[model samples]
Target: MAATAVPTPPLLQISSTQPEPGSLVVEVDGEVDAASAPELSVALEPVWAAVSTRVVLDLSRVTFLGTAGLAELLRAADRADAAGVALRLVGGTRCVDRAIEVAGLAGRLPLSPDLGHAMHR
Candidate 1:
């Protein structure tokens, strides 16, 4: 028998830009799992550190969202609440939506259909 290797998911990529003085838009792409949650957390550090009152996390590009990803998102919501930051999740795919819905966090996390909706809300 020959040995085989399993395929691994791509690493998560997080990027952020401040379009205005008090607002930030963060775009997340690729898979989010236990291996990538830390990257997400590190990327969010600026969100908490900055004076931005509003933050929009764009997840439409996310290909996968695992339990660890969900947990990180919940923690993000808590951190936002405690910090008095208005955090919104925008543009998620079915995979992302299913994970959140299955975890019963759809109601708890602020979700918007797009960037415009997120900014308006």
Candidate 2:
């Protein structure tokens, strides 16, 4: 009998909330590498599309962050701008916050320290 390879757990998991109509908060948890970027985009596209007020990307639970993850955020920012919807990202974990800080995207990505702050801004 051949030994079969076991599949790895999903690198990313996305959960979402809507505090109000046209407002969304999608929470990301897990690793976000080049491998998981596509899935991240797919998960975000609809939320971005449906938002009329704002979209808050809550990244408190994310365990890892990569350049690909940053790119996805940038794209989401662009989409939100084009659609006239506000986009804000809330920093949760230290590692994820550090990644965005190191990438110099804090200014450009509209990042906040918490969910309440992100929603109001």
In terms of TM-score, which candidate is strongest?
A: 2
What do the candidate models score in CA lDDT, each in turn?
Answer: 0.85, 0.86
Q: In angstroms, how far off is 94's CA in candidate 1?
A: 0.5
Residue pairs in steric clash, candidate 1? none
Off by over 4 Å in 1: 1-10
Candidates in order, TM-scores: namely 0.87, 0.88
What are the per-model C-alpha RMSD values against the true structure?
3.5, 1.9
The global Cα lDDT (0 to 1) of model 2 is 0.86
Over all chains combined, what TM-score does candidate 2 have?
A: 0.88
Tens digits of per-residue lDDT for model 2 on 55-99? 888888888889998999899889989989898888878878899
lDDT of 2 at 111: 65
For residue 59, give model 2's deviation from the true position in Å.
0.4
lDDT agreement of model 1 with the native? 0.85
Name the 10 consecutive residues with the lowest summed lDDT in model 1: 45-54
Q: Candidate 2: where are CA atoms >4 Å away? A: 1-8
